[model samples]
Target: MGPPKPSITISQQAFDEMVKENIDDLGMDPTEALQDAIETLTLQGVDLSGIVTCKEDPVIQSLDRLKQLNSNWTDRIGKDGDEVMDLLDKLTELCSAEGSGNAAIGTRNGGIELVCSVCSKLRGGSDQGLVSGLKTLASLLHDVQSGDTFQRSGGPKMVMAILSDISQSSNILNGGFSVVAAAATGNEIVKESFMELKIDELMLQILRTHGEGSIHSLYDAIRILLTPDDNRVVASQVYGYARRFAKTGIAEVLVESLKEGLSSPSLVSATVTLKAVAVNDEICRSIAESGGVDAVLRCIDDSGEQGNQTVARVCCSLLSKLAGSDTNKSAIVQKGGMDRLIKLAARFSDDPSVLQEVMSIISILSLRSPDNAARAIEAGAGDLAIQAMQSFPGAHQMQRNACLMIRNLVARSPENRTLLLHNEIWGLMTTTNRIFTMFKQSTFFQELLI
Candidate 1:
């Protein structure tokens, strides 16, 4: 024990091998014996790169090839053939291939690095090159495998970074928003990530700067963020997100876009997006402040004889929501919005869908506002409501809503009550009571009975 003996440990196999080598017979130190065993294993060509389990994944191998050949892939753009489509298909396949745990490999093995490099090149690249590169990135994002990876690895930031540089080129901007839209569609995580970047402002900027071509993607992106195609009720988080849109003047831009005509996709997009946020008091006020009532009324008028029923329905519903605010009700009535609505109700009296929305709006206008109630009566809304109830006798909700509106019309406006009574509205009271008694416990129905 002159010097304490050094200690070392080796795997059983290595220990046995050392023993078989007669290292103990030669009385070598334990550390020297372990060192000899390690040298033997290292010389045997064992790959110590920490990837011992997953065999040579072909997907990872192909991704590595693409990363190396990304420039070659870029050069294929503008060649005018199956080349671009082929490039897109290949990139899409690579991204999808990452799903079976290959994402981990791709993430670690330069796949995301390649995307960043492509984004960098596209920022300064020619328009054709930019379009192609952006499209490729969009398709990659559409694939579930690369979507999260793309978002987490600065993909969204890279996309946002290049947007300003490409703002002047419609093709380039459209392509950029395609990537943004794809990243946003059905992927809340990425959509929230984009929200953090104030992507809505960037979107409005696109509409402001690039004009018509950017409308589709901007609408699509906003739609995905706000409405979310699911059946779930719009949560407070979505409303909170929509407040940001209103702050960015989205409500104003949307109202102006309505000038695109009834059937215009942009027009429909604008209307629908506005409706989604109309519940916010500030947003509703913004709509009215932005001349939305007049613009919307004009759209309803423009829909004409063969008006888009869906457009009419959604616009009316939106106005109904906006009309909840007193100022909005005044704006609507002043803009002849109430007159147009009455006309629509009369014209589509047989269509329960349109009539339902009309009655709903009339009810809102009549509630808590004597002036608005008088305006509705002046617009022949009382007559229209009675007609809707009588004509759609079987339409339960229609009848209920109509009766409720009649109640609201007469609650504060004696003039309206006199107007309805003179028009034989009392003749429909029996019908109203019958319907109201059916749901007597409902506060609305109870109020209607009174």
Candidate 2:
């Protein structure tokens, strides 16, 4: 625009050397040396347009750029839109760098307020900007301080507004849900804030409106809301949240979503959310009555056919949790859950983690029910457990879970003890006697042997 802005260029190495010279020769503070370098280059008519000035840490630099861009935001999308998106990208990268302490740095630099302001400004104007802002905000809120700031600054309300806007794109809604999930994780006050905003109701409405398209992030947020805090004192609040979610009809909606054919990611998230929501025996029974058991078994069958071990593993875990209820245990058996689980174990025989989940389910199902125990044995759970034990001799959890499943299978059913004994469990036990020594001192292993 003005005589081509007097263009000139320098290599990155050259720029670094210049900054080094300013610090080494001039004996200036690093920040002062950087500023001096920038000033000298600008006065010399050198274009340092694409250079990283190193004036501040990356988190602070990004926040400052975001603040500048927000001030210049206009109705018409142009260069400012591109700059806004770039800043968001840089902030997201900085905050997510593992062990960099950038998230904590960001919180100290008022990143929460700046990013939230950017999101609020970008609302309804730039979908790309709004999406990126939400993503950056999520990363910034990884720690407790950022989450606390977000809650105090009415972040939940802003995020809920973004999600409630029907005119927003699916990408925007997904990003907003991710922010909710991140903010609610391990932070009691933020969780309470989101609860007061009726985030659960909003989540159910979004699921109903968007169906499978938004299931992954929405269910992730739902799961975080229902999960207990790490502190044992607030653990009871999780049960309260679960009850609230159940009363909100989320259990029925979740079961319905499972009935619909979901992709692997969506199915995994749905099962995880269901697991978190089934916090008490009463809620577990409610979900079971809502056909949650059959729905989950169907998910296992579908995921197994697709060779998606992750979905199968999560579904098995949910089935195990639901089986805590006596009624759900029978329901799982009635729905052929044991057969499905045993087949899943066989299909994923190479994965000890999957086998552990399967064995855990069997342990619960056979806890006090001889029929279920017999069904488990009849469906080849004993064979599956023995095979898992033999294959994964070094897997402590797999071995422990197998031992528990065997104990439960025989605890109430004498016929199962005879059947399992004849199934060569004793031979397998002898083969694993050395490995079982790791647990020999434990009473559970002693019971398994007897």
Candidate 3:
């Protein structure tokens, strides 16, 4: 033999204990827990390449039992289907393994057949078996390799069919929606299937009546459906999607949900989704009228206190959009929104995007509502904008928004103009105006000189 094959040295007792800890303490599936334990040991410099494997007979037996139990005993498992899902998670892990080609071909094919069978069940009736099977399929798809294999086997279209099939019972719908969401994670093709089927509106309805323990799944589905992966960059705004989301009572649901003060992952998704749709004036008005302004303001304040930057960022964006409306701008001002935004601006001055949004909101307020503009001025909004423009001289949007807001403030009240001159923004304004005029130059000779 070349060199001795490396092997992991662990007592069977240690392996068992590790697996149990991962399952009970960490909430990992048993198979994953086992794999994690082995990997952890390897990372610690333990060799696992040459461990004497147990006989194949027992592993084959377990695989057989898992397939049978996932398909047949699903209905027999009690409501909520936790027990069945646990077994399926284990089965999913097994089917994706390769063991002398024995586990690879047979187990993988069996898993696909089982998913197809489960998808077929979703087409008609609803039962514990159907629900449990859908949950299992979701777990299987949670693995990237496994989901790809399933999709290649025509399971993606099947999943989409079930997602779009509104006739299914609520139980099946809940389970199916969740499965589709999990399967579609980072899978653009699956995402397209949901979009192509035009299930965005229907999914929103399901989200309104979302099941008890499936809030994440429902929210995930809605987020992915509303916000595609590619556009999740600097500008995640989609006007059409926002318009449609507003039509589906999304604003009302999100606003009302925040009112209850329930803390969940859904809040982040809701805020992000709201940001996407708040481009519409109707949605902005609805958000404020639905008390979303207050809710979002509180979220901004609370997220800052809790160091939840993501929620704070999106919540601020939502408020910025809401402030775009003339009526809502006054509402935000009366609610002390300017003070909060100013504080946030100071705290996050190092962040260009956040500063841009803050200045943009001030621009809108100063443009529409003189009273709010006065309040923003009182909050030192002029200085804040000037600082932001100075900090990011190359950011044309920030500079443009700042100059526009300063202009609006001065135009709104002679007092604000005096204040602007007092703060010494006159020089910055002159420089910015010249730069803007240079940017506006269209002639090649003028551009070359610059």
Instruction: Estimate the Cα RMSD of every predicted model relative to the unseen true structure.
Output: 14.3, 10.1, 12.2
> How do the residues 89-152 of candidate 1 rate in per-residue lDDT, one tens digit apiece?
4655555553344334444455565766665654554556556667656655544435667777
How does candidate 3 score on lDDT? 0.64
lDDT of 3 by residue, 1-450 (tens): 464665546654565687789999999987788788878887887644223223344434544665575567443343444544455545545543544332333324355566566446434443665666676566555444455566677776676677665556666776777777766665555655655665667666666555322445566566655555532244433346557667877778777655544375467766766666677677789888888988988877776667666766777777777887878888888888889888877777777777777777777777846777788899989889778877888777777777667766666476777777777775665576655674444332232222
- Among all windows of ten consecutive residues in candidate 3, which has the lowest summed lDDT? 441-450
Candidate 3 lDDT at 373 equals 74
Question: What does candidate 3 score on TM?
Answer: 0.55
Candidate 2 ranges with C-alpha deviation above 4 Å: 1-56, 69-80, 232-236, 262-265, 419-450
* CA RMSD (A), model 3: 12.2
Candidate 2 local lDDT, 1-450, one digit each (tens): 333443687765788799999889989988888888889888988866335555556777777877776677666543248878888888898778887767766776678888888788888676787888999999888766578899888899999888877556788888998998899887878888888888878777777777754546888788887777545243446678888888888888887767774453366677788888888899899887787887888888877778888887888888889989888878788788888888888888999988899999999988888888889988998888877887888887888788878888887777777777887776776567654565457664445445
Q: Which candidate is the best by TM-score?
A: 2
Candidate lDDT (C-alpha), each: 0.68, 0.80, 0.64
Ranking by TM-score: 2, 1, 3
The TM-score measured for candidate 2 stands at 0.81
Better of 1 and 2 by lDDT: 2
**Candidate 1 ranges beyond 4 A from true positions:** 1-68, 71-84, 89-149, 166-168, 185-188, 212-214, 227-240, 259-265, 276-279, 386-407, 410-438
Winner of 2 and 3 under TM-score: 2
TM-score of each model, paired residue for residue: 0.64, 0.81, 0.55
